[model samples]
Target: MMASQRGDVSAVRALFVSQRASPYDVTPSNCGPLRFAIESGSLELVQFLCHNGADVNTTFGTFETSPLEWAYKTRQIEIARFFLRQGARLDYLCFRGWTPVVLLFQESSPTVPLEFFGLLSGHSFSDFDVQDRFGVTALHRAARWGSVGDVHALLQLGASPTLTDNEQRWTAAFWAASANNVATLKRLTEGAPSNFIDHVDFRGWSILHVAIEAGGLETMCLVLELGVDPHQTIMVESEDSCVMEELTATEFARTKGQATYRCFTQALQLTGYNISVIEDSDTELVFWDT
Candidate 1:
């Protein structure tokens, strides 16, 4: 395990040749030798382990993570592709019920290629929408952080935008909105019904409301242009007193600050709604001649 982690191909080979260690041996943390090789970020070391009977499909660790998942987690795109070519399972669920595809999007760097998704042709439409423990699907992950190309690829591969997470019952569209990904949100709802955009969460917070509070000015404008009700209200519970209050999207934006409030009102106005703008007296001081 130490040799593999250090990328010492010669020492690892010596261990194998001498029959002193098995390629399948796992550390106390349940990480197999293959995982250690992957952590070293050396394709040569990884290939050596696999050639010596390392189980590419074997899931170790508490999360039940596979070698393919490790490859993705480490940003080894070539290794991931190699694992795919070696027939690694794409739909296997790991920690927190995250599938290999879902975990790929969870990565924060090295944007995944659209061609990479093409390798996962064995899965059915339902397989792409497989949810995690929180009912968060690959589409939800893609919508949140993956590129527009990533979202499109998932959609083409049968991921549904309508699937909702367990906690907020937030659809992929909602995730897109909260992430301020206007392009992704637009693409996700391109041909969808008006009710889809206007659909509210468990707290009665619509996509418009989410855009107003968590999204940017452009996102808020886009939601309004998409026919989301500007006057829609949500019942929010206060964290301190647990007080439930119903507030419209505009009113909710006010709590976010003047800039957000102004953005929402301007969006409403552009969409031909009659929203009266309230002046902030605190922002202006009277100048009197003394």
Candidate 2:
């Protein structure tokens, strides 16, 4: 901790040299010199630890997390690459809800090693898109909270937008829609399903319905451009438990919880609030997850 905090690479080097027994130990919370350096953005210290025989691929403790994952997650993309070239596997999925890609994209603009990110680009995978405990993919996180830079990095790394999570639902398209990021959504759906936008959750609403209900005009327009029919009809069960003609986006959402009718009802007029998706159904009223 002292050496890491002070950025004393020399003392750290002498203490952990391979020739020594090494009184200090590496750990997760109290990461050894390398992790601490990565954590603190001390590239100098990181270089020292690596030169002194720190295992670049070592999992600190909890989550089986490696130095590469931390470096990626905390904006040390270069450091992550250094670890990877030293024998870290870029695709290794740990117990935590993260792969190196997840770590790379979680921040506004995560650290992306140019050569490494470039190396993973131009790749493709039918089954490599893995999800963590929440059933979210690296693509999901990037399109949701990441910058265009991060988006481009993962895209180059060959993350599959079509990959689904554990729920057997939610593609990268759904996540982009929910995030209201039209640009990223456009990039992620290049070769997806024709009715991909029409994919309803356990419920019967499609992605367009979600955007419309959420008042995401940009997202709605993008989906429409991607082939979502704006005038599609959706069945809604009224408060009286009776089926009704729900035209426009708000009604469909209100009845089914798209955009809370009561919560944002006051500003419902924002997106032609009164208008909603038209309705039609077999019979029984049921809630669907989108």
Candidate 3:
């Protein structure tokens, strides 16, 4: 990105023209002129970095965060596009996180530029298969960060909100409501399958548990209107999900490794809206959020 930022044609030319037969290491710590230029929004420098052997996918630090993450967090869509053009990988899996796409969703962010969207539209992010250390998905990231635009973009680009992380876990809907994103929640619920209302995690957490933790009335109402169980259990059942226990031939294709999906409907039938009893019962409803 720095190389692109710098707009140094020579630098760009030099990077791709490596004489060595091997690839140059562009780790974040070792990044030079390109990193500096990218951080400073020097498109010329970023161009140079991409042209040279500066990695479009380079993570500046060993923290697993990448320059692309920085670009998204800063809403520097131009810089992000430059990297994408240079072949940076978008969408990560089997990891904790690549960068902070969530920051893009915040209400506090500046108006995102159209160039970023154009670039994003042109590329296919690998978020569908990407997972974080906790088995969280890019959808989870969008939900946690409340980046509905990003979520919509990802969905439009073929990401599955139904996918589970490494843990076979939460849906994008769960995370969205947890982060108090009413719009995201509405979209998720309105478009989800019938069983989603009863979906529970291994710990048996319906999306409502997550939403109450966030404590927004609109979020709660949105979730409620969508029909999640007010009395859903948080403790995951220590058995295979009933949804997938049937014969393989009968089972339609599902997100790999996800025993859990949206089932708030079942959970609601199991536990009606009775927060007071849960608030009073010490052991029976001990998992209740205080």
Question: lDDT of each structure?
Answer: 0.78, 0.62, 0.55
Output the worst ten-in-a-row residue range by lDDT, candidate 2: 119-128
Cα displacement (angstroms), candidate 1, residue 51, comes to 2.9
Clashes of each: 0, 9, 58
| Ranking of models by TM-score | 1, 2, 3
Best by TM-score: 1
Per-residue lDDT over 1-290 for candidate 3, one digit per residue giving the tens place of the 0 to 100 score: 34434555565556656642112445446544454565666676566556656676765554545667767766667787777766677664113454344434444554445455556556744444355566665566665565556567656656677866556477888778766878766766656788887877665566666655555556656667776655443432224664423222101111212221113222322444332223344322223334
Which pairs in model 1 have colliding backbones?
none
| Pick by lDDT: 1 or 3, better one | 1
Best by lDDT: 1
Q: Which has the better TM-score: candidate 2, or candidate 3?
A: 2
lDDT of 1 by residue, 1-290 (tens): 88988989999999989999989787888988888888888888888888889878999888889888777667677777778767787767787787667767764654677655765554331478888888999888888887888888888887888888999999998998898988788889887765786678887888888888773878888888888876677887765689988876766887788787777767766766754554566552212222
Query: Of the pair 1 and 2, which is ahead by lDDT?
Result: 1
